[model samples]
Target: MLPKRSISKSKPSKVWSYFVKSENGGKCKLCQKFVKSSGNTTNLTNHLKRNHKKIYLNEKQLEIGKETAGPSNVNLFNLEAKASTSKAKFPKTDSESKYSDINTDERMDSGSEYSHRSPTPTAAKNSDVNVVICTSTDSQSQSFVSQKGRKRQQRIDQSFSDISSFSEGGNKANKVTNAIIFMIAKDNCPLNITEKVGFQYLMRTVAPSYHIPGRKTISNLMDEKYEVLFKLMKDKISSIKHFCFTSDVWTDTLNSRSFVGVTVHMVCENKLLNLTIALEELSKHHTGEYLADKLSNIFRHWEIPLEKFVAAVTDNGSNIVKAISILLGKSKHLPCFAHTLNLVAQKVCEDDAIHEIIKAVKQIITFFKHSVAASDELRKRNDLKLIQSVPTRWNSTYYMLEKFVKISEDVGTVLLKFPDAPRMLTAGELQIINEIISNLKPIEQVSKEISGDSYVTASIVIPLQNCMIKQISNLSPATDIGKHLKQIILSEITKRFGEIEGVSLLTIATLLDLRFKTIHFNSPLKLSHSVMKLKRLIEESQNEIINEETIEEPTKNENTGSIWDYHMQLSSHDKRTRRENGKENNAGINELDHYFSQPLVDRKVNPIQFWFEHKLAYPVLFEIAAQYFPIVATSVPTERLFSRAGNIMDPSRNRLSSTKFGRLLFLNSLELIGIYNIQIK
Candidate 1:
């Protein structure tokens, strides 16, 4: 009914004599069973041994005879003559002789090429003998062969039916797919990366068995991963007693889309943990009411109660401040200290005297930025390149001025070669630049020190502000511009952070820190007020603990005897001794006084570690520290999230949907803190 499949003649095997070859497998001539070729004869030999034992034994014996018969007995000319004569005598039919001519041609080609294992005497003798036996078979055997051919066809049909179950759902496939998903999330690779030619070629070369998933499939996997990680994050957050949130709104420049990024900070097991919890798209107006609702939704989604909310640190945006105030009374919101410092520095730059010198420096840097020749000439003279300052960046002006002063001489020399270049800064201007740098350097340093989320920055607010004020006030400027700059910076510092020490939240945190207990406080009234507030809180916490303990029923011993009376008396005596010792140690000492009596620890020590080590001694204070220490000094953590979001929404991936964009960012944030060690099963 159909055309017969042709078999390849290259490197003919002796096994082919007992089989009819097909595209994917071969059919045995002896018993009519199909065997998958898969490019070798191992299955064919097994079929012969299992279905036709006598033929299999004969084939094995023939192989042994060839090994025993030495090459000295094999005559090449005689073998060729015998093969030609045997082929003529057998006179094979078209179907049976199809392989006979091929075998003869192979032997001839082998002899001419001097192939190793030239026709052995036993192998030639066996081939000729088999040809005679096969030709002399009876007519009934021919009929049996045709019947077996039909059975072989039926077996081939059955084998084809089994191919449907072959799929890319194996364990190795799944493991590779999970690895690819993690790689995409960790590296922020575009979803379509799998569709690229080079990526496909790489997978084919390294792991040909694995099937790369499409973009939609990978997106779904990411969603599942996000859900798993979100639960892990939620479970972790629920166990924490206090949380401080930092939030900000960022607008993507390419698509003009806005996203609100919220990050949570807390102290857990003596370690400070921060997680980027939300990066949702802001489709509505960013009004105070709208933002308040969004913030509440985030907390509600995580199942964090309002009572556990310690404070929110954000920039001095009126809308966000009002939102936090509306959500958690006015006392729960704290202005970002770094943002306030940035305002202080920005305000100082706005002064006319300072503005003029900054303008001149900007113009000079601009000239070098535009001209290649002038820039190259300056590079030849100095290794430092001029830095350009952006208005929105903190400390950028000071950094630019600092660099310009270092390379001013080389810049002047370079400008002399170009007549059209902007004039170099005069000596008087240079003096002002140095004065500005000197005045602003302390502010820059203070900003960097306080913008940390890994340490107890809330406690450092009062002390650092005091240090900055003292540092700036003590500077003696030589010029009126320097003096004016000094006056402006001091005023800005005092105006912005002057009353920071009065805030009860920060005041208590500052006092609780062992490194600065009551040492940095200048106002006795505020200190007394903070002490009174702390005392009340500790009293309330102790009362609650006492109530909980009282509610639990004490266990009664059933085996009461006079023998345990001495143990009871010894316990009572120990209790009386402890009471007397407590009275001596706490005569007029409350928890605050006892805490202050201990020597200050080194400033480099982690306050969280200290509190954990001394929690039993100062349980109430430790509870308060847990609440207040997590309040970060700045909203920079949210700013960093927006920076990452910008990278994820690069030009090539600008069209990524908001949902996918958020998930990728969430996974990436987890990756940053080393919490994303998930395996897709």
Candidate 2:
């Protein structure tokens, strides 16, 4: 066996150590990141002043040390200053260049706080002259090493061309949209979703240059770039106008604080020009007035001119309405006519006689709905038509009122035409039918032009004509019914203790249309139910939030709502129960549940709410927009920029400064071929 070699002692690491020659010509101490101040510290000082001038420093000592830092003293900046005389030596490399290795070594050291770090070459190798090392303990800096190995320059125009069941989209979206998303997460959506779903899908469809990563990549990216994406989006959002505002804030089933959301929508020049998201977090003691005040402050910060506001719509919450009043100096509200009509029908049905008629009609409807033969027979009776009549159910009660009248006539005319059809009889039933038929008489030709005798039809025609005229008379589509709804909104009246006009007119009109419940002193259901509904709506209005921007949507690129409704549709994960996604994930990451479960106000209270509250309202607004306003908007132009943004900065390359995101969006907008009309090439 060979004799064991003697162990040799190795030198200690000289990382922070520097052999500085003392003024007495003796070595004093060593320092790592710091060395002698040459012409280097001068540039560093200037850079600090320019870049980090406002950043926090040990200011307590900086001012005092400034005067003492003049010269001569070994203690400058209250720290030892190394002399340039004894410069440290570094290794040399063979390239036939003068101290080439030494230059590389110095360059490597340039990765200090004193330097602006540039992206290091990916192919670099560790060596005496070209060592790859990181000084900071920050884990983020280290991730770059891996990016070099995995990242590829996105096929700028084909990012989403071949989504292997996946892809992505937007304008440096990771940077621009992420910032917006981050801000949203802070207040509205807490779902911890790093990648947007609909946008991602749309990216694959619209912009061919975007692609979503694999699932594993997405999960990892979520962790790393969540913050980056949010900041980027926010930065991009900071510069826009005419934003569509959508707000849905709610408490848990527990009914806690008022969590409000403010989303801005601007579809300009045929693109979704800007979609900004904001959240208004309120304490439990929040009120309409307090909420309005806070919202006013935020609007002032955004430079949004309240005068330019085309509309401020909200769900039926009084508080949100108050906020809108604050957001848009004042408003002439438009309430949902459909909702009012529902109320009217509800009232007319409340009468005992009308109630019996409704019951009888509904039963008859159900009977025919359940029987295809009866429905077919009714259609055939209406001039011998097809196999079936659409709307076999009673829901189209108004139109059905006319159809049922025909059915009754047909039954009476062809009473023995079929055995399956039920016979019409009974004095009481017939009397009720007479009332229903009489009310519908004038509109139809059931009776002769004058019946040749006035008194013959006075009992029916007088009341029916008055009801129809009254119900249809007060209707002013130009005025959103909800404007004077306060008279009917119990909460508003109770809380304010004020009387409202148009209440009786509205109620009587509603009764004529069979759209309202009878509100009589003798009723047990109580008047408060109606008021409670109004209260609920006002309460919801009191808690709305939204953002706005100015961009017109191009009719050519307009979204007629695809197989998936992007803007108007809710995110699927909006199910309130979903908090955290996978187990063992970072804590507080899964806040999406808070967003989906948020309480919403009624559309009646807030005009915006009317469009978002019901499917009918949304389409109604679309029709109104298409007809009244130039349906082609500039909002889509802004969305295209956002789409471009998401394209540039995505999960794969998430981190980005806000400034860069804005610049990219601006560039994309200028390059637009067409926003209003789809351009050829």
Candidate 3:
């Protein structure tokens, strides 16, 4: 029998000899360019055929020579006929029309189209082997294409599964979670927002790797965040040497829940820092003792020392005032200046003559608000809308009267269209309204200027009020009712704010302020008293510093061999005695004299900035200024907290627990003041 021809099993393609194989594919040895084929040699072969034609032709000749030697030497699985046939069958089409179908009979074999690349002349001598190899390779190619599609689909599904299983502690997940929490707190969103279908869908779309936490998880996270921020805020407050607090009680109409809010203010590093320190549920009756105990607890919880409490500003409510006095001291409680001004406005509006005029204006505004046609006509005549005074908001009455005066003619025309509208104001009534607005205008402006918490409002209290009084007194009204209104406002102001300059806190603050140092004082006795009190504070501070120094024992002389040791001891004793005596006798008075002797700083200059710049020049005075400058002129900051709480206690979140509500409001306040930032780590 003839010796059997050795047939090699399928092996790596010869094209690999010119390339280096990698996990994904291989790189060409000659040009070092990558070609991806996923362990297949079709693309590798194409790379050589396109750019290395000479080498490709040489390899082809060697393969063809071996195949033609005999049928037994042929390895059918190792042939490139299938790749060539696939290329011919799926020629590259225009990119835009690459997916367009070409009509063909499904029954036809791939070999029929394979006629596009005719075989070489040498292949005809081995037609039987060539024909057999091509037929088998064609079937294998079809299976390979189908298998590739399945592998691609499997990869896509695996990626999606990986994304869905992101660990909760992953950095991306934590970042997204923090952002959601910030949004919920800042916007006062309902806790159930994360559980809503639309919110979940949005999260998934934006960050597929992040798992949307449930409402319970979000709530727990918020609690943890609040605790962390609470500790941070406490640490910050601990560094402050002095603080002024504003407190108020608000009742939520939606849930009939009562809450007390307290805000703390201080000047640190020449910047005004204010934060909401407490927003707790008021479960007990709001008596002076109950509220006082609650405030004491809050102060204790924050670790605030009694000596650090400069004062507490609140509305003129007897209960709250008594509460503050009970906790801090009788002299440590200050009534809100803006609230007092509001009272003045309210009291004057109660006059029979002004009440009738306001009543008529209210009716006209009501008609325009209810009738769309009348409102539209008014808008056409003038863009200004008639305002209705809200009893809760200060200056709202003045705003209403002022608006009516501006659009009085338009009001007449619109009222003509509605026969049932209130009668148009007479010329005399119009004159009275103008006069009232003019008189109240200066008071309104003063109220706003002093209600600020971001600047040295305490110092401006006396100056601004003095200026307002002067401005109002200069105005001469033509109408008798206007004159009566003016007199009522002046008397009310005097009755309410007449004793403000007598308060030690405001008096000293004004003295320390460069812009109005004893300049706005109407009472020489009060001014002198304020000067004496300030000098006493300075003396006390100096004594404290000296005591602290004396408490530190001097280092003992370890080696007393030198004869000058005795002289050194005597010199140190004399210097120490002279320093103590000098500070006690002249430090406070000299600093005070020096500060007052300097020309007044420009009114436009910030008082805080001025103090900071000259702290070293007037260290004793700066210390006192630090304590009093942060005392806001009004309790508006606390009032603002309640206003925000009202929005937070909307219908959807009326069932929210008081603890969570307080946390949300606290975090929101810190965010506004830039004290708290979300940490994603």
Candidate 4:
């Protein structure tokens, strides 16, 4: 009903003083309501808990008089009251008080205490027999220090002090660090971010108290983080028995430097994992030997099991081909499908009709892009903005032409407004633009479908190539440009991939796909060859498994005493020796045969998931599928890594070391070991 002020002036409680004021009959600070000064603090305590629960829960009662305060502190006023109730139980006589200052230590043993009664007590019964024990071993004379007739008047205050320091801001510091790293990676900020006045100002404005780390501190932190993430990834790689790699070399022309990137792919627990395994800056020669040595070093460093290495996909460059062949054997290197397609598209676009149309289109787009007035007028006509083609990029020309078609009328109007503007495209040129889009559309679609890193793209290569060639053959030479385009594409494809390459690893990938299963192949001879290859591979794997089992459990020869038993054993051994050869010859032939006899998989089925569900039915084949399915048809994974590196090591930041550049690129791509997983301001 009332609030009370603590009497202990030497040490006061901040919580009590703050909530219950000493003015106006103990007014509550939060509610400003007057309470009766009846020496009761129930109302004040309730008010603080109800009105300001958040502050009340987090704030600790401060010790005003102590040199150092702790989290745990008992109320001195309450302890004194408990001591007074227990004083009457322990009484002392005058005789004990006379010798209270004698040599008590000499009379008592090693285990001793100064007081005979308990210094503090919480019950009435325990306080009656409370006494102090000595801690010395010298038992010269037994002398009592206190009298039995006198009650103990003085009380000894006891308090437990907590020694651990408070540092609850560690979580906040971690969050800030993650935010800084995220900004550096996502926005491609320089490592010397703290040195820049603008960056420092921005960070200070956002968080005034946050201590920004120096460049070296940040770099060391990232290096430490890299080791942690590498261990996790290394463990995952070690667990996988089979995997494939996609590698490529990227030339940064502005910096005149080249780098090699390798991406690792595998299926673990029915889910596909595509991760950038290596992105190394190459300062040495780009010769076959140099590249091969670099790749071998990385494989050895990561402990990549070469015995399980299936194949590698790279561009058609001779050095790359030779390098991959050296590392993974000659039969295992796959020329990047997307690069071959780019070349085919590039060659087909070389016709005079297509060239004239692309030139005019580029001129028109450049005019609109440069002249803001022209762009505004074009935007008013149609809100579509034109995209200029980059010669180095694939599918860029198709996109440029397609965008122009959408805003063709606007362009015609814009050109009419300026007499000195580039000449408008003729009807024939416009026709060529539409034809180019038609011819290149299929190439663009197929490129995207195969470049996907998450699923089985190799299986679709043969089927998709067959479909493209058939589409090109049906063009019927409707125009001069159409005939030229069709001829260029067919020649390029026939020269690069052809029929035989399809029946190679590409067909093996398709055979693994239950969805396609030899149904799309037109040539019976190639189909039979693929089936035979699949059977042979499976048989080899089965033999390896059997040989290992045999090594683990070898047969033993023991002699029998009876002549009849010995004769039977000799005959059985001869029969068993012949059967072993036959079993080895056809170790895993039936699994393939059984799969071929089954119905073809449906068109809409997911190949990876299908293999996963049916893995137990054909476990050996599943192991083979894991080896082949992750082989991406293109080196796009490495190319994408180069794209990020390009942004990081820009012309202005050319002085950035390769280590910093690679780490930044890696952090940008993989989100720096899951810094992006945290939601930070």
Could you tell which candidate, 3 or 4, scores higher by TM-score? 3
Please report, in order, the local distance difference test score of every candidate based on alpha carbons: 0.72, 0.33, 0.74, 0.65
**Least accurate stretch of 10 residues (summed lDDT) in model 3?**
99-108
After superposition, the stretches of candidate 2 with alpha carbons farther than 4 Å from their true spots are 1-286, 290-307, 331-345, 349-352, 363-681
For candidate 1, give the lDDT of residue 81: 23
Candidate closer to the true structure by TM-score (higher is better), 1 or 2 = 1
lDDT of 4 by residue, 443-522 (tens): 88889888888778888888788787777677665568866777777888888777644447788988888888776787
Off by over 4 Å in 1: 1-175, 553-589
lDDT for position 519 in model 3: 93
- The best-first sequence of candidates by TM-score reads 3, 1, 4, 2
User: What TM-score does structure 2 among the candidates reach?
Assistant: 0.28
Residue 345 C-alpha lDDT in model 3:
85
Q: lDDT tens digits, residues 275-377, model 1?
A: 8878888999999899999889988988988788899988889889889988998999988889889989999999998998899899999999999998899
Candidate 4 lowest-lDDT run of ten: 158-167
Regarding lDDT, does 2 or 4 come out ahead? 4
Candidate 2 has its poorest 10 consecutive residues by lDDT at 672-681
- Give the distance in Å from residue 191's predicted Cα in candidate 2 to where it truly belongs: 10
User: Could you tell me the C-alpha RMSD of candidate 3 in Å?
Assistant: 24.4
lDDT of 3 by residue, 1-681 (tens): 999999998877767766566789875543334688865799988877775454465457555654564222212112222223232222111112211111110011233322444322221123222211112111211111123223111244443443443336443344456557777888889988999988876554344345678899788778766775675466446667889999999999887889889999988777777888888999999999999999888889989887898989998899998898888888898889888888888898889999999888888888889999898889998988899989776578889989888999989988888877878989888888899898889988988788788888989989998999999999999889988998998999899889888999899999999998999999998888999999899988887876775675264332468888777678668758878668555787899998899888889889899889989998888888988888988999998899889889998899888888988998777655543431310
